[model samples]
Target: MRKLIAAGAAAVALAAPAGAEFASDPAQHLMRIERDALETVSRDRLQRLMRAAAEADEDVVRVSYDGDWLAGQAAPDGGAEWKCLSEALYFEARGESVRGQFAVAEVILNRVESSVFPDTVCGVIEQGTGELYQCQFTYTCDGAAETIHEPEAWAQVGKVARAMIDGAPRALTDGATHYHTKHVSPRWAGVYPRTATIGVHHFYRKPVRVSSN
Candidate 1:
């Protein structure tokens, strides 16, 4: 299974688009600051910081590749692929078991399909109100210090992130958008339909009721 997963990841890397836009531009440097601030501060504050970073570093906007300036764009950033996936795993699952970490990623993707959120993985993860506490994932809003001292676990999570980003079918959570540890039951869990249980986490999906008259 591990070999298959690794092979699949490599294939996706090879198949990734070669367009320069898919390549990481300096503007994405702003995301690095945003992600860091999200881990330790409020999302609204992070947005303000991002704007400041962009304005303070006019060179970031003037960064040109060959002769063209790269702005308001996104790229695969294969060089940073491992780092990106590793950070996602750490922030999203540093508290969960291994399987539970992957499950969290699954739920994030599921929200992409629903009408309630944006249609991209990063979008879903970062969507939030002005307040730090209002977001899809609590980690993004929580003011906890982000650190990864466990190298082994980080490697495993990196593998999972690579797989999911590479288009591995989300076979675990089954379109779940909400989940919580077994320690407590949130009020919404009682109303939503239980989907799947992976590791210590309980997954849920919005309920759809069908009535027969």
Candidate 2:
């Protein structure tokens, strides 16, 4: 009879949920955050889970990606991905309308999706960050301190970054993977197809080809 009992206790141990792991793992923290938001999981256990996740920068954005949840969102908790997006919006389109800001975010997100660019937001934005003037974005290599003196602007842009990171739709730039402000027209602008003009910026995308027999 004992020999016929398959795996018994050992199998049960393997099946135990990831509850014990919630303390040290950020992935576990995300699960805990979702559970806590729903208020359906072990509430007391979630407190510890959340504490673990909040210690890291990337996982905090998991809970407050929506604009409505800004009240509980902590901007400093953002990891490098969030920082890149927020800084881009701040320097590129903070003066533009909210729609335009989102449009810029859309462009950055589009770059992430494209095969030519990096797979992650941070990688795309920081592609040319260290070069003198060849950096993809001007602010990165322009020698200005990447400081946030405008709390209000930072907060708003933080929300935009979170929104974009959470897979927000990309409609503003017409799938544009590149953009330049109206003040300067780079030589590449003539080669790349102009997709749309949003606020002070001109958006562009590489032309799609139709195969001809």
Model 2: how far is 6 from its true place, Å? Answer: 49
lDDT of 2 by residue, 38-155 (tens): 7854676788788777675453334333346555655633788988899999987788767778888888888888877899888888888887888888878888888878888788
Task: Predict model 2's lDDT versus the native.
Answer: 0.75
lDDT to native, each model = 0.65, 0.75
Residue 59 miss distance in model 1 (angstroms): 40
Q: Name model 1 segments beyond 4 Å from true.
A: 1-85, 95-97, 208-213
TM-score for model 2?
Answer: 0.62
| Highest TM-score model number | 2
TM agreement with the true structure for every prediction: 0.53, 0.62
Residue-level error in angstroms, candidate 1, position 171: 1.9
Q: Provide the lDDT at 198 for model 2.
A: 77
RMSD of every prediction: 26.5, 14.9
The candidate maximizing lDDT is 2
The deviation in Å at residue 3 for candidate 1 is: 63
After superposition, the stretches of candidate 2 with alpha carbons farther than 4 Å from their true spots are 1-77, 208-213
